[model samples]
Target: MQLIKLCDFRQPFSLNDVGCGYGALLAFLAKRHRGAKVDYLGTDLSQAMIDQAKPSPRPSMRSQFVVTGDIPRVADYSVASGIFNVKLNQPTVRWTLFIQQTLAGMHAASRLGFAVNFLAPPGPDMQAIPELYRVSPDVWASHCERQFGAKVELIEGYGMREFTLLVRR
Candidate 1:
């Protein structure tokens, strides 16, 4: 969330990190923004992941998961990272449908929309990944723009050709 820190998070917020593998990033951001004291919710299909979560020596502020099928539970100004890249091995339609559902959940709570990442065209993270619904960063940009009615703002990272898009509606 280094890039996110560089942006405007001035709005009062609650963030949802969907499919949060192990709450590493969620804990980091929650800790980092402790002064703001925003409510942060992180969800993963695996209960083991959440059980293992340890928020380093912070106040009572923390991360927890709402059930998957319940999207309206998350609050506004939500964020998600690396949603699509991990689901590469699933059927395209299935994964895309999942994307829609996930966004719908986030949108149900988000007033500012969500943020995500994808490798640049030709897929920087393509290798060793199951090639299910893999597509270029541009395609993902268009898809989000079309689907979410938001502009896809892209930033090329320090060491990789891949780009991060912070989309807002």
Candidate 2:
């Protein structure tokens, strides 16, 4: 939810929840932002995930869930959480390219801004996990600033070994 704080809730807005597993964000908004008007669209690549999300209690009549890897329409804001963490056996170069392209897509889909979280590099004492994709925050912050001409804000040290990039256009 902290990642979505980049959005303004004082008025009605539309949101695209990329990789919205089981529509968890919708439930969070339903409970926490009951008075705020939100038109929510949840997208995931897995059909089973969409099926799981469809039966969940909806926050509003405007909410919809779809099985897709891309955002279907422009929205006021877009958010992706824990989407870039697991790389499995994908090579670093390919994974990095995928992240860059996904970020570009998110920037294009969002009108106000977009936010995404990534795992931070492992501590010196901890053995690096090959399956987990982690990097210094500056790598993507610089990309958002230069590639999208966005005003990027890095949110970190919130009691997690991760950081979120809030890219505002």
Candidate 3:
């Protein structure tokens, strides 16, 4: 939804879907941007996801699905949706490292920018949970700005329990 608006779509460009699952985002983009030219690549770590997304790829755009540890090619823009939500018992330090590495990769692989969403930290009245990672938007946005020298924006107040970080290079 909001992730699609992270970059300008009036011109031809490439997009890398980091951690894409089943190509649903690709399909939605293709449908939403019918007249705009786009090159879409969806990368996932799971072979099953790639397999499921390979068939009947979106016809509105040049599309490919790859099972890879990282995006294999540079694109005009990139997005990671719901990738940082699941912590799965991983220590916060280790997961933060993974986020740093992944965001670094995203910055290096995109010519324009990248967008990612993180589950918002629970309120003081609510107890923190272990299975899900609830992070402060400022924490990661500041990290992107400092580490990548990118103009970072935090999009919130959408009535959702999450926020998006739009990093422009």
List TM-score per model, in order: 0.76, 0.95, 0.94
lDDT of 3 by residue, 8-76 (tens): 877888999999989988778767777767788899999998888853334547888899988899999
Which residue pairs collide in model 3, if any?
A: none
Write one digit per residue (lDDT tens) for candidate 2, span 63-115.
Answer: 98999998999999999999999999999999999999999999999999999
TM-score of model 3 relative to the true fold?
0.94
lDDT assessment of candidate 3:
0.89
Candidate 1 lDDT over 1-169, as tens digits, reads: 5335423556556666676767777567655766555566777767777677655345545456544535446466566666666664577788878777776666566776667665454444446456624456677668778877886676776576456767777
Highest TM-score against the true fold, candidate = 2
Two-way lDDT contest, 1 vs 2, winner:
2
Lowest lDDT 10-mer window, candidate 3?
A: 52-61
Question: What C-alpha root-mean-square deviation, in Å, does candidate 1 show against the real structure?
Answer: 3.3
Deviation from native of the Cα of residue 50 in model 2, angstroms: 0.9
